[model samples]
Target: MNTVQEAKRYLDNAREILREKAHKEEGYYLDTKYVKMAGHTAYVGVLVALDGLLGKKGKGRKGVDWYNQQLSGLDKRPLRSFVGAYDTLHLSMSYDGNPLASVAAAGLAEAETIIKWVESRTVEA
Candidate 1:
């Protein structure tokens, strides 16, 4: 499959994990482990979509700095979305394991935005 498909699968898997395993109670998830897993999974999906559009820098390994730099040069709008994804998906959910349902919702929405933006660009190219 293409990068868009692959990236979307990652996101789908993340949603499934949250829906099936995270054990949501009202507006929060009870399982921090599952939350972390889903966050990491979704964040990776964002990276995959971005990489598909940006290509690899081939500077040993990639990091947030590299991604932000490339995206900032390309377009500031998507750059903001990506930064939000990193903060919400990567840091808040993945590391801190924030249990707020709204946090996850916002993060997931941001991931979707980045992936769709990448898809639009790739399809146009």
Candidate 2:
């Protein structure tokens, strides 16, 4: 599969995991493990989308820090979304046992938005 296809696959996988595994009926996730897993999964999807975008510009795969730096120079909306995912979903869960449901939900939404934005800029393999 191509870059976009790969990114979409990751995004879809993250969405499924978030909906099925990370979801909680109490309005917030109680399972720290699932929260961390979901965050990591969604973060991976964001990275894949970033790779797709950078690859299109003749850039090779880079670290998360590099991606963040690049994102800082791009559109503010997606950059904000990316930052939210990175901060709340990707990193914050490690230190917090019970992350708020709104935070996780927002992270997922941001990731999905980033994936969609990347998809819009890419073509099928």
Candidate 3:
């Protein structure tokens, strides 16, 4: 499968992780581990879609800054979405393990926005 398809699959898996594993109660996920896993899965999906659009770097992994610089040259809208996704999915949820369902929803929305943007620019792989 192509990068976009793989990325979408990652997103699907992330959602399943949250729905099936992360126990939601009182508007919050009770399991931090599942939340973190879902967040990381979704974040990687965003990166995978971006890599398809922007081309993958060789060797060492690139940071968000590099992505920002490259995306800034392309369009400001996706760049903005990328920033939100990075902060919400990567930092708040993935690293800090935020359990807020609303926060995860927002982050996922932002991830979707970026993925859709990438979709517009790329053909199926």
Candidate 4:
């Protein structure tokens, strides 16, 4: 598959894992692994999908800038905020010991929004 399709598949699989975790008792806390995995998957998948769609680079600082520029139209700034929030949360989880509670919340919200955004785009395409 192409990068966009691969990324979309990852995000879709992540969403399914997240939903299963969300159904459990203690949910988010009990299924921290799924949450963490989903967060990372969504972050990378969304960035790759965005880069593919916008015809830009697919990683690093330039990739982030490309995403921000492509999503400069939302009223509440959901797209840009989602990307930034997920990136920050990913960094914290991957490097800074534990992921902060607030960052987790932000990442979860961002993940959900990004899935929604991708769905809409898929429908449009």
- Please provide TM-scores, in order, for all candidate models, with all chains considered together: 0.98, 0.76, 0.94, 0.54
Residue 85 in candidate 3, Cα distance off native in Å: 0.4
**Candidate 3: tens digits of C-alpha lDDT, residues 1-125:** 98888988999999999999999999999999999999999999999999988887776889999999999999999999999999999999999999999999999999999998999888553
On the 0 to 100 scale, the lDDT of residue 27 in model 3 is 94
Q: What's the C-alpha lDDT at position 106 in model 2?
A: 79
For each candidate, what is the lDDT? Answer: 0.95, 0.72, 0.93, 0.59
| Model 1 CA deviation exceeding 4 Å by range | none
| Lowest lDDT block of 10, candidate 4 | 92-101
List candidate 3 stretches off by more than 4 Å: none
Comparing 2 with 3 on TM-score, the higher-scoring candidate is 3
The better-scoring model by lDDT among 1 and 4 is: 1
Residue 31's lDDT in candidate 3: 97
What is the C-alpha lDDT profile of model 1 across 30-60, one tens digit per residue? Answer: 9999999999999999999998998978768
In model 3, pairs of residues that clash are none
Off by over 4 Å in 4: 1-5, 8-39, 57-61, 73-76, 100-102
Give a tens-digit lDDT track for model 4, residues 31-123: 566667766776776666555555645655665555566677543465666556556546653344233445555665665566566656666
| Clashes, model 4 | 0
lDDT value, residue 9 of candidate 2 = 75
Candidate with maximal TM-score: 1
